[model samples]
Target: MSKEILTTKDLHLYYGDKEALKGINLNFDAKGITALIGPSGCGKSTYLRTLNRMNDLIPNVTITGTIKFKGQDLYAPSADTVQIRKEIGMVFQQPNPFPFSIYDNVIYGLRIAGEKDKEKLDAVVEKSLRQAAVWDEVKDHLHESALALSGGQQQRVCIARVLAVSPEIILLDEPTSALDPVSSSQIETTLLNLRHDYTIITVTHNLQQASRIADRTAFFMNGELVEVDQTKNIFMNPAEKQTEDYISGRFG
Candidate 1:
């Protein structure tokens, strides 16, 4: 059995008077891809942010419940948010690479952490780009502005930036939603290859993408998890009628 890397119990969140997440309970395996799918405003993205305390950035936001990472309480008063974020990095929906050179973008985190060794930074940049499957395309253009690359390449570079930090888990929020089919496919392939090394959790609107790359799938509706199971079972033999209906295009 796979070890549980992250777990949530009765997790709840509110933005002022309105509730966003309603007692979410889920566990992520140490290694593999888990996709969160649902209609717009279903709280998948909000829940994803909660895992790394991203929601803390918003005013009037409040969270209640236990979120544990590696058996340590992520919400504990003593928990270090910066270290948590470093260990559980996030890739946003858009390919928001910094306006810096590709090499600088990939090394930004390390530099911020006080790493100044030229050799180590060079090695990490190359290794991360390779792991993100965009090394060959960007190797010759390492000094070029990241924005100069195509959307797909920029997204991959962003992924490399996250990998350079050597996070134990990666959170992707609709990562391929802004890309073309070809670009999306490339991102999917990169994710598939990364699953063996990192625990990945992604929010996606494309059911096909979820089925193709996710080892497990969780369906959410009205801020509540409708069902979660193996990808095959979730698509072929879901236990919930709502899940079946959504998967069959009946309703979201």
Candidate 2:
């Protein structure tokens, strides 16, 4: 078995007075892909955001319990939000590239972190773009505005932006929902390649996509974790009736 790089224990969350997550406990393996799947409004995305403390941005949000990355409590008062975000990056549903050049977009995080070396920035741009599987397509067009690229290209650029920071984990929230079928396939392929270097935890509504890319699958419903198991088991022989029902399309 692989090492557990991250773990959540009795995690709970609330947005204002409504409970959003109900005691979620899950472990993420090092350099592996874990997919969170559920029906609409099931709190899977909420749980994903909590891993990197992204939920802190919401008003009247409260979190309890613990999220530990390599044995350190992520919600501790001394925990650094900026550092946590640097080590655990996120890619949202839409392809939101900055209005800057492709090269500049990739290096945006590094630049903000005060990396002033042009040679280093150039090297990271090439490496991150290659890791995102977009280097060959945009190598010669590095100076072109990222906003001018296709949606798929722009999403890949976003992924590259996250990768350039050398993060240990990448959180994806339905990253391909806005993309075309071909583009979605390409993004899936890129994610497969990325697992060799980064631990990935993604919230995906598409069961097929989750089965295709994840080593482990976690099912959530009504703000509670219903089942979690190996991908094959989760898809082929889920232990819970709820999981089977969801997978079989009886109900979401």
Candidate 3:
């Protein structure tokens, strides 16, 4: 693998002539947390989505420059979108579980990827659930409706769903924004464990959450990537004053 697991060079994104991300250059090391923090509409989520080509699903969205994973351009015409997405899974702000049982929810990704063997699916479900740290709570109730799960459990279920596909990088867009304090802590602990195996890139409006969980941090303002460095440096003594201002709650 390359020294940089993921890289974006001069990336510019436009949603029908409205520039959402300015020429942004970024790089991610292997199996570490990189948090994108900014105010609302600063393009934090937009920048995160572009990494895995999630923006491809939208209409009239144009992207420029190169986004590479392991030295291969992600936007090449011959690139496989489905395969790209599978390798770089995403969890959203809201925990949107499918209308199915807990067991089914974890296996949905495998099933869609054409894994039909019952033994393999079961193993994956168990491994992924364990990885997401929700297997024990819902193990006895695997057959119960996913909708019956509480907001936090449902979010972990979503995380398990993403893990089942064996993604190399996980993109989280405010994964804990909808949860309570306890639920937020649960997700944070889970993410810390996940960093051992998966490269995590998260976009969060909460500065404290970034401080707690991120290995490195990037700050964005008005669609421009302002500062990126170690989480401690970015928060404690930011190279840019804007980062200090944001974290200090002087201005968002």
Candidate 4:
């Protein structure tokens, strides 16, 4: 059995007076991809942010829950948010690469953390880009502006930036939604390759993408998890009628 790396219990989030997440309970295995699928405004993205305290950036955002990472309470008063984020890096929906050279973008986190070793940074940049499956495409253009790459390449570079920090977990929110089909497929392939080394959690609207890359699938509707199970089971034999309906296109 895969070891559990993250868990949430009775997680609730409120943006001012409106409840965004209602009593969520989920756990992620140490390695493999778990996809969160739901309609728009179903809180999948919001819940994803909560895992790394990304929601804390919003004003009037209130969270009440116990989120544990390797058995450590993530929201504990003494928990180091910076270290938590380093261990659990995030890639946003759009490819939001900084306007810097690809090499600089890959090593931005390390530089911020006071790493000034030229040789080490060079090695990390190459390794990270290789891991993100973009080294062959960008190895010769390391000093080129990241924005100069195609949309899909930029997303992969962003993924490399996260991997450069050697994070144990990667959170992706609609990572391929902005790309063309070919780019999206490339990103999916890269994610599949990364599953062996990192625990990946992603929020996506594409059911086909979830079936393609996710080992497990969680269906959310109206701020609650309708069902969660192995990808095959969720797609072929979901226990909840709501899940069945959504997957069958009976309702969204």
**lDDT leaderboard ranking:** 1, 4, 2, 3
lDDT per residue for candidate 3 within 1-252, as digits (tens), equals: 365899999999999999999999999998989999998999989989998888988999999999998788999999998989999999999999999999999999788778899998889889999999998999999989999999999999999999998999999999999999999999999999999899999998888999999999999999999999999999889998888898898987
Q: Give the poorly placed runs of model 4, Cα more than 4 Å off.
A: none
Per-residue CA lDDT of model 1 for 1-252, tens digit only, reads: 249899999999999989999999999989999999999999999999999999999999999999999999999999999999999999999999999999999999999999999999999999999999999999998999999999999999999999999999999999999999999999999999999999999999999999999999999999899899999999999999999999999976
TM-score of 3: 0.97
Higher-lDDT candidate of 1 and 3:
1
How well does model 1 score by local distance difference test? 0.96
- Clashing residue pairs in all predictions, respectively, total 0, 0, 0, 0
Model 2, stretches more than 4 Å misplaced?
Answer: none
TM-score of 4: 0.98
Residue 43's C-alpha lDDT in candidate 2? Answer: 97
- Cα lDDT tens digits, model 2, 1-252, are 348889999999999889989999988889989999999999999999999999988889999999999888999999999999999999999999999999999999999999999999999999999999999999999999999999999999999999999999999999999999899999999999999889999989889999999999999999999999999999999999999999999997
Residue 130 CA error for candidate 4 (Å)?
0.7
lDDT of every predicted structure (CA atoms): 0.96, 0.95, 0.93, 0.96
